[model samples]
Target: MRYLSLDNQRDGFILAARVLMMVLFVLFGWQKLAGFAGTVGYMASVGAPLPTLSAIIAVVVELGFGFLIAIGFFTRPVAIIFAVYTVATALIGHRYWALTGMDQYMAMINFYKNVSIAGGLLLLAVTGPGRYSVDGK
Candidate 1:
């Protein structure tokens, strides 16, 4: 596609990117909301500090901020927040170095996945949410 044509599609592309990135958070957040006790228990089992608080934060960040991102509202700052949150989750929840065998392998995979998600969010921070967003409006 030509530069101008592609430029016209910029908003569409950004919308796709923004929504796609938020999917994981939104879905997981919903799951957490549906199973609050289980979520807290899982967090405690993972040795997360203040399991209840962490679970609450997870639901807010994932569902709340994730919704904002989906609608392109406060996209830039929210994306940065998501990026940082993603990295923190990786460090706090996926400590592969403290595990062994298959558990270690899964943690390693999850850690990298969170890191990769953070990277995408960082890019979204720079790119903004394009013309289809409230911020863009």
Candidate 2:
């Protein structure tokens, strides 16, 4: 069977995918900043060291780097960093093994979601942002 090709719209496809992938980070990061105290409290509850600092870093990575990814600036490096960050967050925040019942199920779902997002980021890193990006590659 023949498969449809997106070669003609590759750049547009990349831009759309990048924007979609980063939108969650941008929104969540903004939320974290808007509710700084609440975010810090949650981080502390999760046993994160220097919760305030962690929150700040998370905001930067999510908002700043996420924007960069969306705009296709430094696409490869940003994708790689975001991929690692996604996995790290999943492992740190979604410890399904440490929970039970519904909480465990929820955490497991989120963990896998994060992992899947990371996989997409990794693919973006390899393929790049395409010709319409700042990298123009």
Candidate 3:
């Protein structure tokens, strides 16, 4: 078996990573928008200050920034912002330690998942979007 050269694989690898990273944001953002009132209610239940405003911000950051990152436009700053947002959301929304039983287990899983995603975004910030991206051009 032969491995592709790093130079040859870099752009494709970056594109794949970017796509994967953006999918969750895009889908969830769309869901939030599609069920705007429900999302606002959910945010309020989670103790988010100004639930409507929080919902809007979540939509913008998730959908807007997610799209920008997917296209590789302003990749570094976007990824960094997203990384911060991911950590914040995980802490605020996934308070696993405060929960019990299955809820605790689920929240813990989500918290760790968010952390992992944030790690990926940080990597993208450092490595950039590569040659296939708008930022690259």
Candidate 4:
């Protein structure tokens, strides 16, 4: 009975997790869209190759893939892509070794956070979007 209850709650929990995780990406993507030039500048500052294009990709990935995940469309593949993107951003944008002291500390923190998010995304890829999603588990 209890086990069945937990199983029944699975989809709801997955939905909640999907929404919560995607919120950050969507919000960040919106920020990038709102400040396109600034996002390009920041990408350049982070030494991202093809800064303008990279910024555009970031916005698209964060918003497009983020939305897809939130709505549970093509969830598995998108989660995998999002995980890779997250890790790539961690490596490219958060090169803590290049900085010193607090700056380095902060960058390292952000880098690990990105990595953590990526891990969660991979888990989502494995677990799938559940019955609440368009993918229908």
Candidate 5:
């Protein structure tokens, strides 16, 4: 019974993580495609040199990696990519907001949040999707 409970817990965790990944990625991917102009503008605002390239990357990463995450296919690779992307975005975009001083405290908080998320992604990459995943089969 104890083993069964442990299995159940791990399965629950994987499912929750997968679902969260799916929802966030799908929404982000849709937004990138549907609001290309908005995405381009956001990229420009963040000082991204190639807004078009940024948009393509966002869409591909969100949709492609997101699907792999949801289905538990190539989970580690996808998670690694997401982890790197999160860290890079935080450093490139949010770091500037923090440099602007105390008025942009929210930027610092968000930067930390992104780092935390990257940590979680790294953990998932290492631990995998548990027994609930298709790959686990």
Candidate 6:
């Protein structure tokens, strides 16, 4: 019988989740920066009051939080920030129930998925980054 210590398991979880978050953040953030016009247009389509400003903010938040998560520096704060940001995205961008005159059902499902992921991120924030993190040192 072999057993992984509590600390080891927690660190493994943190590492996996952190890497996933890093990839997600970097990709989305880079999209916003690389395709500024497209991002602005998408924001406008989604009824963003200030599409340009929203794009900028999204880029910064995703990139900044992504870096923070990757390094495990202030992991809790970064995770919380990401959780809140994802929630807002789910609400505003994928307000599925609010969609009308088309296939609205699918939108709601996606929104819920985003919400679930946000919940996971919130959990990570509450749990901290465990023994493998910079804060654990």
Instruction: Name model 5 segments beyond 4 Å from true.
Output: 1-7, 96-103
Which segments of model 1 are wrong by more than 4 Å? 1-5
lDDT of 3 by residue, 39-93 (tens): 9999999888899999999999999999999999999999999999999999988
Ranking according to TM-score, highest score first:
3, 2, 4, 1, 6, 5
lDDT of 2 at 89: 90
Mind giving the per-residue lDDT tens digits that candidate 6 earns over 107-126?
A: 78768877887887888888
Question: Which residue segments of model 3 deviate by more than 4 Å?
Answer: 1-5
Q: How accurate is candidate 6 locally (lDDT)?
A: 0.81
lDDT, residue 85, candidate 4: 97
lDDT of the candidates, in the order given: 0.93, 0.92, 0.95, 0.96, 0.81, 0.81
| Pairwise TM-score winner, candidates 4 and 5 | 4
**Given candidate 6, what's the lDDT at residue 44?**
94
Q: Tell me the number of clashing residue pairs for each predicted model.
A: 0, 0, 0, 0, 0, 0
What lDDT, from 0 to 1, does candidate 4 have?
0.96
Error of 3 at 28 (Å): 0.6
On the 0 to 100 scale, the lDDT of residue 46 in model 3 is 88
Choose 1 or 6, whichever is better by lDDT: 1
Candidate 5 per-residue lDDT over residues 1-137, each given as its tens digit:
25456554877788788868577767878888899999989999888769889878888887877777887888888899989988987887687454766746878887898888889889889989777677888
Off by over 4 Å in 2: none
Which residue pairs overlap in candidate 1's backbone?
Answer: none
How much is the lDDT of residue 112 in candidate 3?
Answer: 99
RMSD of each: 2.1, 1.4, 2.2, 2.2, 3.1, 2.9
TM-score of each: 0.93, 0.94, 0.95, 0.94, 0.83, 0.84
- Show the colliding residue pairs in model 3: none
